[model samples]
Structures are given as C-alpha cells and as structure tokens.
Target: MPLNIDFQQIFLHLFNFIILALGLYLLLYRPVVAFMDKRQAHYEELDRQAAEKDAAAQQKLDAYDARLKAADEEIQRRNADANRQLEAKRQERLQRAQEQADKLVEEARKAAERERAAMLEGAKKDIAEMVVSAAGKLADKEIDPAADRALYDRFLEEAQAAQEDRP
Candidate 1:
C-alpha cells in the first residue's frame, strides 16, 4: 500500500498469463512434438528396409561368385579332356606312320632280294652255256695248245661284250 501496488490487478495479469501458456501448449507445442515423433519413426523404418535390401543383394552377389567359379572349373576340366584326346589321336597317327615305314622298308628289302636271285639264275645259265660251247669247240677242232688258247680268248671277249651291253 505504501509503494502504491494494486493486488487485484497483479492477480488478474497472473491468471491471464497462465491461460495463454496453457492455450499455446495445447494448440501448437503438442502437435509439433507429435509430428516430430512420427517423422523419426518413419526414418527409422526406411533405414531398416534399406539394410534388409543390402543384405539380400550381398547374398545374390555371393551366389553369383560361386556359380562363376564352378563354370571356370568346368571349362578347365573340359579343356584338359580335349587336350588328352588330341594327344591320344597324335600318338595313334604316329604309330600308324611308324608301322607304314617299317612295312615299306621290309618291302624294299624283299624286292632287292628277289632281284639278286634273278641275277644269280641268269649268271648260272650263261656260265653253263659257255662251258657247253667250249666243250663242243674243243671236240670239233684239233687239240693244239695254240689253237685252244686262241679259242678261249675269243669266248672271253664275247662274254665281256655281253656284260657291257646289259641294261
């Protein structure tokens, strides 16, 4: 009372301030807080879904890698089989070639032997004819030593000429 303060006016202002604060809390503050909480939950769910998708992608990648490795091993196995087959074919061809060469060599040797036998038979016939001719000439002519030597020389010259004209 001495400082001239009014108690009723102070009480009225205090009551008005409390009402204004309660109205702002109900109309604005409470709705904003609820919207923020809802946004936080939505972001958390999105993060969880992204993590799940990443895990699925990783699993797919692992499966692809395993398939690729299996394919590579299969290719290597097939390649090795092909190489082995090629080697086997090569060995077979080489063996056939060697056998053919041996056969050819044997054939050449047999031909040479046959030719030698034919030559020996021809020489024997020629020698026999020469012996018969010399015996006939000796019986038909006189047995003079000089005449016999001259006849032998003539037969030797004819045999030499026959050999020189041979193919």
Candidate 2:
C-alpha cells in the first residue's frame, strides 16, 4: 500500500480538458447556435408582416364587393323606373289616338245625316212643283188663268188629304 501519485500527469490532464472546451465553443457549438437563433427571429418577423398584409388586403376586398353590390342595385332601380315611365307614355299615346279616331267617326256620321235630310227636302219640293205645273196644263182651255190657278190649288188640297188618309 503506497500512496504515490503523479502531480505532473494530473496538471497536464486538467489543461487538456480546458483547451478542448474552448475549441468546441469557438469552432463548432457557439456559431451554430447563434445562426439558428438569428434564422428563427427572421422567420418570425416575416410571418407577422405577412399576416398584417393579408388582413389589410382582405379589408380592401370586402369594401370593393360592397360597393359593387350597391351599384348593381342602383342600376336595377333605374331600369325599373324607366320601364314604368315608358309604359305610361305608351298608354297615353294610345288613348289619345283612340279619342281622335272616335271623334273623326262621329263627324262622318253627322255629315251623312245632314246630306240625307237635304236630299229628302229637295225631292219633296220637286214633286210639289211638278203636280202644280201638270194641273195648270190640264185646265189650259176651259178656265181663265186665275180660275185655273184656284182649281189647281183645290186639287193640291184634295191630294194632300187623300195621302193623309192612306195607311
């Protein structure tokens, strides 16, 4: 049982461990960890900006859709009003044309009635004059002019009485 240990060997082993740790931190571990942290922070900032931009674009699209819908409704209302006004004007023109046609027909009927009455009156006057002239010719020799005139007047009176008695 000898308690004999090497101090030089122990000191050399401790120095080697410290040198190995420093090399690992400087060449491999610290650089990789720092690069990973920087990449994570960049990706997070990009994701946040993308989300904000998407929300803004969505709001703009919704406002545009609402404006288009309002414009379409306004056009529909204008078309309906125009159709109603056109129909009203058409009806008014048709009614005016019908009224004018009715008036023209009425005027024609009145003209025909007036012409028929005039013809009837003229025919009656011609018949009366012919009867008086024939009676004067028949009594030319047997009666004076004044007496023949009186006789023709009496004949005309009797003729009117006979016509009245007939059915």
Candidate 3:
C-alpha cells in the first residue's frame, strides 16, 4: 500500500518458499542424515568385533607362554634327577672298589704271616737237631773249656748258614 506493492502476490511468494523448504527437509535432508547414522552404527559394530578378536589372541599368547614355562621346568627337573642318579652310581662303584682293595690287602697280610710262622718252626727244628748232635759228639770226647768254646762257635756257624737259606 505504501510503495504500490500488491499484497496478494507477496503472500503467494512467501507461501511458495515455506512449501519448498518443507519438501526438501522431508525428502533430501532427512534421507542423507539417516544414511550417515546408519554408516556410523556399522563402523561401531566392526570396531567392537575387532576388540573381541584381539582379546582372544592375547589369551592364546598367554596360554602358550605358560606352557613354555612349564616345559622348561620339567626339563630342569629331569636333568637334576638324572644327575643325582649318576652320582649315586659313581659312589656305589667307588665303595665297591675300596672294599675289594681292602680284602686283597688283608688276604696278603694273612699269607705273609702264615709263611713267617712256617719258617720260624723250621728254624726251631734245625736248632734242636744241631744241639743234639753237638751233645753226642762232645760225649765221645773230653769236654774241656776250650772244646766247649769251639763247639759253641761251630753251632753259631751252622745257625748263620740256616738263616742264609731262609726266604
């Protein structure tokens, strides 16, 4: 009314603009926003699944490490047991060898003692026979002090000869 503008035409243009905005909001804008929300949800699900798979892999790694530790401990225990058994066997063999050596030494000492006893007995018999022979020869002659001395010297010579013959 003030600038000679028509009120009916202005009202018509304003109504047309409002209708176009409403149509775009319902058709293009709403569909694009819904598509973006859907894509975001899909990506979130993929991330959650990946986290679960990583947790499972970590659990498997821990299990394998535990198994390896147990295997190493078992190997050490077996080696210790084997070493102990070997040492025990070595000690037993050493003890047996010592016993055998002691037995041999004792037997040798006993044999030497028996031989010495036999030699002493043989020396006693020879001395007794020499004494009897000297007495018989002295009885056949006069036994002066000089003759007694001479007989003693002869007996000493025979005893020395017997000693030389012994082993």
Candidate 4:
C-alpha cells in the first residue's frame, strides 16, 4: 500500500494478458501456421509432379532418339546389302560374258583349222591332176587314175613330213 501500489489490480491485469495471448494463439496463430504449412506442402507436391513429368518427357525423347538411330542403321545396312548384291550380279555377268567370249574364240579357231585343212586337200587334188596331165603330155599316153591317186598320196605324206621338220 506504499505510494498507492495496487497488487490486486496488477495480478488481474496479468491474468487478463495471459488469457488474451492464449485466445490469439488458438484463433489466429495456429490457423495461420497450419495454412502456411499446407501451402508449402501443396507447392512441394506440385514441384515433385513437375519434375516427374519432365523426367518422363526426357525419357520419351531418349527413346525416340534411339529409334531414329536404329532406323538409320537399318537403312545403311540395307543399302550395303543391296550394293553387295548388285556387285555380285555384276561380277557374275562379267564372268559369263568372258566365258561366252572364250567359247566363241575357240569355235573360231576350230573353223579356221577346218578351212586350212580343206584348202590343203583341194591344193593336193589340183597338184595331182596337173602332174597327171603333164606326165601324159610328156609320154604321149594317158595316165591311169589309180596310179595317179597313189602318187598323190605319197607326195602328200612327204610334204607333211617336211612341214613337221620345220621349227
């Protein structure tokens, strides 16, 4: 009671202050804190979903790139196979052409040999007829066909032997 000090009023005022603080904590502070916590959680969830979507998109892009690369490789492989087949066919055709050319050359050589043989036979017959005519004219008599043929054969053999002796 010194200097009009009021202990009861001070106690009452302190009690009123404590009650008000409790009311504020229940009505305003707690709800505000809970609302802030909910908003933060919502934002975090949205960010997580966005990150997941981005990852999925990136995965899809990687898959598409892989497919594109595979397609390019397949195309290259097909082209190589086609080129190889074409080359093989070309080589086969060239070989066939060479064989045909060789066959034609061989036939030509055989034909030339037959022609040479025919020419030699015809020359021998002509020479034999000339010799028979010359002998008949020198002897003033006709020559027998059989004897002329024998003499022609002997001359042909001697001519063949002489040709064989040449280098």
User: Which numbered prediction scores highest in lDDT against the true structure?
Assistant: 3
Candidate 1 lands at a TM-score of 0.69
Name the TM-score of candidate 3.
Answer: 0.59
lDDT of 1 by residue, 44-145 (tens): 999999999999999999999999999999999999999999999999999999999999999999998888788778767886899898899799988999
Give the number of the best model, judged by TM-score. Answer: 1
lDDT of 2 by residue, 42-154 (tens): 99999999999999999999999999999999999999999999999999999999999999999898888887677667657755776777766766766578977876787
Write down the lDDT that model 1 would get. 0.90
Q: Which scores better on lDDT, 3 or 4?
A: 3
Model 3 — which ten-residue stretch has the worst lDDT? 1-10
Off by over 4 Å in 2: 1-15, 126-167
Off by over 4 Å in 3: 1-57
Off by over 4 Å in 1: 1-18, 134-167
lDDT for each candidate structure: 0.90, 0.83, 0.93, 0.87
Q: Per-residue error at 116 for model 1, in Å?
A: 2.1
The ten-residue window of minimal lDDT in model 2 covers: 158-167
Relative to the true structure, candidate 2 reaches a TM of: 0.61
Decide which is better by TM-score, 1 or 2.
1
Evaluated against the true structure, the overall lDDT of model 2 is 0.83
Question: Per-residue CA lDDT of candidate 4, range 10-114, in tens?
Answer: 999999999999999999999999999999999999999999999999999999999999999999999999999999999999999999999999999999899
Clashes of each: 0, 0, 0, 0
Query: Residue 131 deviation, candidate 1, in Å?
Result: 3.9
**Cα TM-score per model:** 0.69, 0.61, 0.59, 0.57
Ranking 3 against 4 by TM-score, winner:
3
